[model samples]
Target: MDKRILVELTTEIVSAHASVNEMSREELLDEIQDVFRKLNALVGVEG
Candidate 1:
């Protein structure tokens, strides 16, 4: 996987979390898990 893509995706997830005001702890955790899943899938892709 490209390091740039991983970094950008992480930045996006962080930005999205920072923008959410009403999310509960569990919701935030779930969101993070989702992000990991997405990153894993992207890493699995062959260029």
Candidate 2:
């Protein structure tokens, strides 16, 4: 999968969750990181 698609998907995931509740700066970053982590795992990305 392309990195851009991963990024867009991650953004969508985070945005969907964030839309339900207001997140602090740290929480937002954590959400983004967590989504990327899961995405990377699925893609076999070692990062």
Residue 44 C-alpha lDDT in model 2: 58
Colliding pairs, model 1:
none
Whole-model Cα lDDT of every candidate shown, in order: 0.70, 0.89
TM-score per candidate: 0.52, 0.84
True lDDT of residue 20, candidate 2: 96
lDDT of model 1 at position 22: 74
Would you list the clashing residue pairs of candidate 2?
Answer: none
Off by over 4 Å in 2: 45-47
Best by TM-score: 2
